[model samples]
Target chain A: MSHTVRDKAKLLARVRRMKGQMEAVERSLEAEAPCGDVLQLLASIRGALAGLTGEVIEGHLHEHVVHAENDAERDKAAAELADVLRTYIR
Target chain B: MSHTVRDKAKLLARVRRMKGQMEAVERSLEAEAPCGDVLQLLASIRGALAGLTGEVIEGHLHEHVVHAENDAERDKAAAELADVLRTYIR
Candidate 1:
């Protein structure tokens, strides 16, 4: 549980770093801004959103499934695992 | 890329199988199985979960990020990359 929380924090930090950016989009593509100038920027935003969702799902699966004490717990864990897979598939 | 899409499909299939296993685990738990057995199953499930996560992250990085075509693509790739990281961190 505690670990999950810490992990979440770490994820956020990572996001912050990414935001920094992607190094300003690689300095605007080496100043060669073209090709929709940032079609990628939009993509980036989408990615961020997906990332957040993934994190949440991951945390939930790990914490709940792992914490399980009995067979049910095991099952839960399995489900969590599946969930992670789902994310990948998506 | 096409490969990515195909990979996604494979991952999804794996998840489906895992989901079934999870269902079985639930049944076992309901059967009042021993805590030890259930615990073992839990561990396995956790492993599977981790494995799936790792694979997805690896694929995304190697394919999308590395293959990015332009600065925008790079940014998007970065964001997507961040997204995956967030999940891992969590």
Candidate 2:
């Protein structure tokens, strides 16, 4: 089975929670809550989505890159990941 | 200024790198690289995208939630973030 399939239940749970947070943001907007409140809600939702993305990334790393059998493959994976990280963190 | 606006150049550079990684994945597939190689490339791309998501999340947390003017707003933001995290990490 694919790693994602193995972790489907857990990943779906996160997505569901993110959906709920998004709904709350929508409701806040509809209710004309303070702009500050709405912004806070949006920030929370963004963080939730980020968490979900991070989980998937971690799973991919463990399943694909970290476990590769050969040094060349591992080096390629590490280099690609490093390059992206340098850009991402900036 | 909007946090994203202030950091637009940096964010765009990351996005461009992610785009390149995605293209590399595509090329690997086209060239009939090993499945493991393709998977590793995909994993790297996913990690890059996740990194971008994380940056956005961090910026939102700092700009919107952390800096809110009142206790009530902060509490609300914290609660929402906590709720989402409870599900996200599972």
Candidate 3:
């Protein structure tokens, strides 16, 4: 789904930062930086990505599933959405 | 991703029942059923639908976001995922 420009902008900013960090991480690997520091960076990146995924899913639910007019359709839609969430939560 | 046959079957069953209920609801409206009864049915359908949506979102996160290999990509994905969950939780 298409997001608002502001939303897209914010996400892009985060992505850019992540890109820079990752590039630096690549350099660290080449330079044989401390394993602990590399692991820490990996963890930080993982957390940030998880947060971004949450945003997209939430926006989709609000715009599509919440306003569904057909009760049966809504049920189906919700189930499909929930199926995704169950995995995320797990 | 395609679901297993069992998952699809179960989802179909729920969908079918929801369809039947919605049809019955329409009939009730035509017959002027009690407002309270109609409202109660509406509530049940809404809950079921919400549950479904949660599932789909969760599934997508696990399949796509969780297994990201690139640190930059993972961070971006996670942030998006979290953005979605925040709304779901709310």
Best by DockQ: 2
Per-residue CA lDDT of model 2 for A68-88, tens digit only, reads 668876786666556545644
Better of 2 and 3 by TM-score: 2
CA lDDT of every candidate: 0.50, 0.56, 0.64
How close to the true structure is residue A40 of candidate 1, measured as C-alpha lDDT?
43
In terms of TM-score, the best-performing candidate is: 1
Superposition TM-score, candidate 1 onto the true structure:
0.45
The regions of model 3 sitting more than 4 angstroms off are A4-6, A68-83, B1-90
TM-score of every candidate: 0.45, 0.44, 0.43
Q: For model 1, state the Cα shift of residue B20 in Å.
A: 2.2
Model 3 quality (TM-score): 0.43
Answer with 1 or 2, whichever has the higher lDDT. Answer: 2
Query: lDDT winner among the candidates?
Result: 3
For model 3, residues B11-40, the per-residue Cα lDDT tens digits are 777778778778878988999999988998
lDDT of 2 by residue, B1-90 (tens): 545566656665665565465456445544545444544554565565456556655655675588866887678666665654464455
Tens digit of lDDT per residue, candidate 1, span A1-90? 333344534544544544453344344434534323233442453355355445645555555566655778768667656645654554
Model 3, docking class = incorrect
Query: Model 2: runs farther than 4 Å from truth?
Result: A1-90, B69-88
